[model samples]
Target chain A: MGQNYLASLSHYVPELLACLTMFGLILIEATYKEEEKGRGFFFLSAYLGLGSVMTFSFFSLSKPAVTIFTNSLVIDPFSSIMKVIMVLGTLLAVYITSQSKDIEGNLKPEFVIMATGVLVGGMLLSSANNMLVLFIGIETLSILSYVLASLRKGDDRSSEAGLKYSLYGGISSGIMLFGMSHIFGVLGTINFTEMAAALKGVETAQLAILMPSFLLFLVGLGYKIACVPFHMWAPDVYEGSPLPVTAFFSIVPKVAGLAALIRISHNFFAVEGALNIGWVGVLSIIGALTMTVGNVSAIGQRSVKRMLAYSSISHAGMMLMGVLVISELGTRSVIFYSLTYLFMTMAAFMVVSFVNDKYGNDHFERFNGLIFRYPLMSIALAVVMFSLAGIPPFSGFVAKFHIFTALLTKKYYVLAIIAGLNSVVALYYYLKIVRLMVLKDAESKDTIGGFNILNQSVVVALTVPVVLLGVFWEKLLLMADGAKIFIQ
Target chain B: MISLSSYLFISFTLFIAGIAVMIARKNIIAMMLGIELILNSAALNFAAYSRFVNNNLEGHLMSLFIIVIAAAEAAVGLAIVIRFFQIKETIHIDDAAQLQS
Candidate 1:
């Protein structure tokens, strides 16, 4: 038994290293004096730690799937790819925080520490294979995120964001637990493998209980991914929190939730049954509704940050469509979409963070005539917006194209139509920013202190993938195809 | 002797009451209590089901973890609530409406 545990530990190296990195960050933060502003050593250690984590997960991507920690957790290519994306998102958010003046200088290190903690939770969530681990992972992600949302101490808006997030989060998780308890009672197991095995033989009476229980389970995850009905906290939390926190929230938690959701959908619902039909039906309705509501709500938003929040909800809806199809093709497309979304969201948020730092607000008018001042940054934002709106010649378009293919394969034509229309609606708001940057006159000729050469280069570097992937996406599609969800 | 159905009925009542508290209560702390009620009801359900049906250890283990996690969640939730109170000088849930569009 001890030897078996050792073997499992060997496969768990990446998560262990990520935990160590978070601890190292805390120790480093402690050693810094109160008056110190730029803790260069702290950031250097953070970069090294996260870089090592990303490298380890990347190497593990091609290895065979292994269920570690006594079958409670999985280390698979699909999860490895997700961890890579989440860590990269965290790394980029940290870099954005380091450059932007949005977060107080003193509080910046705390952001790094909390973000690393959240990343750990995300990693756990993406790989969880058992009910207990999944519950723990979700709680870890939620608790740390509450602190991150209210990082601006004494700020009313920030505290309120944290409050709303925690309240809604608590209620949803509790409801999910109720659902899970009933499932455990009926299935006689919490391990997903055993549960799936048990599901094969359930009677109609069991099916009735299982269906609602699974929906309850979905409430927690859907809340994390910000789907409709469970998405009330998203726009408020996104707009109220600091920009870097918002960026992290959009990428890490959403991807982790989607990864878990895909795994669950693939595991238990892939087989034909009333359960499968019911689950897919519910997912389809939620997907279509989430897309329409998010897009329509975004059209009327004046705050650029809030608009981005709505747009992200719509993007999640699109990803949900991929999950509902319950095929390898659907899973692969979802993975590819998330990878593209990481770059587009990061680049867009970086620009917005700089703008918010300068004007103290992120309204549409703040971006007036940005091209004249910093054309590189302006062009990068435009590319990202176009990509986000699913225009051609961007990775966003390719990602959406793959999703459409997955939908058509399943004959979910109505969903495909809804998603296509949402993209067009998205274009109007996305292009509005572009128009403001290009056509409108500058409000002031003053330089934005946040857009230094280093920052501009980073923004441009991130945008490169958004444009390059649109044309040369076949290679990535091939890679995603290899990242099959390992079903035992 | 207490039956399984009786436990389920009690838990169901608690669940409904928790939801009612959350929906009807205007106080933030009251809402937090509602969340606690919901979590406890689930924990009770797990323990009941474990004792009555499965006879396995997983349900007991789940309930234990639920207890530990609920405390942690409450700690964070309360901290955020304290922060909200400090800023707004009120614990009314309506005061949290600043982010509403």
Candidate 2:
């Protein structure tokens, strides 16, 4: 009995550590004086402690896949790496928030606490093996995100963003639950492994219900990842939320959502001749539409945040292409792409948040002639932009190249072509930001000032990875490859 | 005795009604009610399926969980709606379009 208890505890070490840190932070916040400056130190310690625990867990828990806690959660290499990524991403986001002008004073601690809560949900999501666990994880993540979106308190836009996010999230999750009911009716089980086993002999008549079940399931996951048809809420939400929350919304949930999708797809759809649901065809079409819509609409956005929102949608589409292939190589590419994407996206949004804080707005005009005043920041932003555009000698290019090569390897030639074309369209808007910053002169010199050392340091720190990952991607790719054994 | 299809038909009607209300309603609270309807329909389906098809308690358990989740969602949704109403003095979603591109 003691051995069993110990094993379960070890299985959830990282999540337990995060939960403890969150409670500790709450206690500290409760005790601190209203005007205390030491709160920042506590927040920093909480993030560092959480990050270190996740990193430690990632290296130490390298055992083969095992189902614990009555098989509701699975601990494996894939989830381990994804959990580490989510934790590190949360740390980066908290750092950016600490530097943002939007969230100030006592709100900072609340923000960190809520962000940590979301990270816990994400961790749950990446490892969930049961439908109930998955649903709970998604809702936990969604509820926290709604609160985070409206964290700007007095801002009308932020409140509206929160409302819209909740409405959309509520409806989609409802639909997903309905789908789950049908799936449960058909399979009589919620455990993924058992469901996969039962699905092997499903009749053709059952396929009718199963197909819609699959699509309905996609609705929830698609909304989380902000893919098309379900992506309408993304731009408004991203535009309205505090910058760090927007950054968090873009990367962490999307990665976790993709992880859930991978789990579902591997268990249900990857079994050839068991259930021929044609999910690949549907996902491929969605991928095509998602990228097209994302890139096309991005061209007209005046707000840089909204443009990044659309770009993220397009990137989701590209990642979907990786998912469609359903091979070890394809999975590795998606994982690797997500890792590289973490750095590029955080760097870009960090620059945006800094610009917004300094200039008071995130419009393209504010970015104009930015290179003249803050040379270091501008260069960092330039590197980030070039990488985001998937230019050579940068991480984004390598990520995209991996995705495209994966598609081609699967003989998804048409998807590869659509993705290739979308890259060109994506390049135009990314470079437009670069042009505004570098080529065009600032319309007014009044806004010129030296870069904030803290902001500049953060931007530089994030950009280094974007460049380093591009040059030495093999290390990350090797790690990603290690995470590909999902179906065993 | 009622058949499985009858329960499914009722659940389907509930689901459709929920979707229609969600699409048609302009008031955020009303839309939230629509979401509740959708979730309850799903819960009903789970209960019915467990009783009639699976012959097990899993679906009933799922419905119970769904109830809890729907309550939590409603709580958060209503809070956001209240916050929005306080800010704009109106509950219509159309007026909250200040962030549009």
Candidate 3:
């Protein structure tokens, strides 16, 4: 009775505090003047961000780290690392909302609600030791995201994006849930560690259940990350949602979902349960297809968001390689890669926001003669594009190198070769964005003239992280190493 | 009081009906009802599965939470769909293709 009470208390406190703050922000926004909403949004995000950091710091780790929640909600170094990334990434994404005029009228507070909801989900997911908790956490994030994607209810494109996205999301969830049932039946446990232990002695009956369940889980995760074979909704959704929502969607959810993927794969599939060497072929084939299809589809895209959507799918492919490594090095590589990728992806989308606002169009050619027009934004766009293309001295390149080295160490020779070659293929499309911004002719001077303070601040804040992470990435790499030990 | 097979069969029947609703309905509200049906079937399954397999109440409790969550989802999803329909009229999803705002 006491334990159940404590569990309920432990579960509800954080969730309640988070939800109350979100509601309070909505109420506060009602009294807020138009000019005050931006600052209100910023302060709310800051409060939430600091609170999350404190929770992560106090609950999970001492100097070496604290304790956990019943040892089920793991407050380990690995979770700490992902939690920090999620909190910081979400903080920036929230601020991006304040700067953009994407949320019209009183609907702006909904962004706060949805974004905070996503953060809560991500945080819980990173800490989930029980499959039950993990499912709820993941579903919470997905449900909120589907709403956020289509929240621009006034926009037809937004509705389409929402419906397509929700349909796809619902199906994935169903498949995954079905798989979870099989897994639960086979292992007879909901706790991940216990499940892992049970998996060891189980016979073929369990394998039949385990393998399909694992596949279903991965399929659902794949949709969130927008990897190929399950990436169809991304282009339309990204293109249709408000720019800030797109930016938030691309980075924050991917990081959290991938973190869950890492935990699940490392805990269940990497060693104990059916993780024979043969699984390598499965990972390799999926990874190769994700990259190839993403790059190929992106090549013909005209819309910036559509292209970035495809681009993120390709990056998901790259992220999958780290999971395939399933080693401590691979875990570290994924963590490091995500940290860098967050900044670079944010920087790319910030530029997208600018172009969308200034010209009211996100078509690739809409950026004609951007270099002469908005010189600062042009440079940022080029840097993000080049970084995304894996060019040198950029964070994306550094992270890509880390993954390549990790894969090479694992001696997954084909995956290593495919990843390296795919990076080259990726260059063509990322360069296309850069080329449009830098070398192409400006159709009009309309986009370059105005520079709002909010826009300038967001662009600068996002850009600094990308370049700095690229230039001096070793310390971050060391942190990834720390987290890796926990995952492995 | 029911046999496990009958319970399973009933739940499966309900699940199939939900799938049919999901496939057959063009009305957004009806589709949501279909989702509720599907969730109800899952809840029934959980109770049945637990009775036959584990003899625990955890499954029953999870199904309860699942039903609660499905209610929340239906409320939110239908609101969004209704708002969308107001603007577009004729909530036939095929007509709403201006998806690049």
Candidate closest to the true structure, highest DockQ:
1
lDDT of 1 at A276: 89
User: Tens digits of per-residue lDDT for model 1 on A1-488?
Assistant: 89999999888888899999999999889888888877889999999999999999998988889888788998889899899999999999999889878788999998999999999999999999988899999999999999999999978999999999999999999999999999998999899999999999999898888889899999999999999989999998998899899988989999999999998998899999788899999999999999999999999998888888889899999999999999988888898899999999999999999999989999999999999999999999999999999989999999999999999999998999989989999999999999999999999999999898889999999999998899889876666556544443
DockQ values of all predictions: 0.90, 0.84, 0.40
**Between 2 and 3, whose TM-score is larger?**
2
lDDT score for residue A410 of model 2: 73
Q: iRMSD per model? A: 0.7, 0.7, 2.8
> In model 3, which runs have C-alpha deviations exceeding 4 angstroms?
A1-17, A33-71, A272-281, A446-454, A479-485, B1-25, B98-101
Which candidate, 1 or 3, would have the higher DockQ against the true structure?
1
Q: Name the runs in model 2 displaced over 4 angstroms.
A: A1-6, A274-277, A443-450, A479-487
Q: Model 2: how far is B38 from its true place, Å?
A: 0.7
lDDT of 2 by residue, A130-215 (tens): 89899999999999899999888888999999999999999999999999999999989888889989988889899889889878
Model 3 interface root-mean-square deviation: 2.8
Cα lDDT tens digits, model 3, A32-115, are 776653455546654664476547443443234323454456656776667767766666676666656666745666776688
> Cα RMSD (Å) per model?
1.1, 1.9, 3.3
**lDDT of each structure?**
0.92, 0.86, 0.74
Worst 10 residues of 2 chain A by lDDT: A479-488
The lowest-lDDT stretch of 10 consecutive residues in candidate 1 chain A is A479-488
Worst ten-residue run, lDDT, model 2 chain B?
B53-62
Against the hidden true structure, what lDDT does model 2 obtain?
A: 0.86
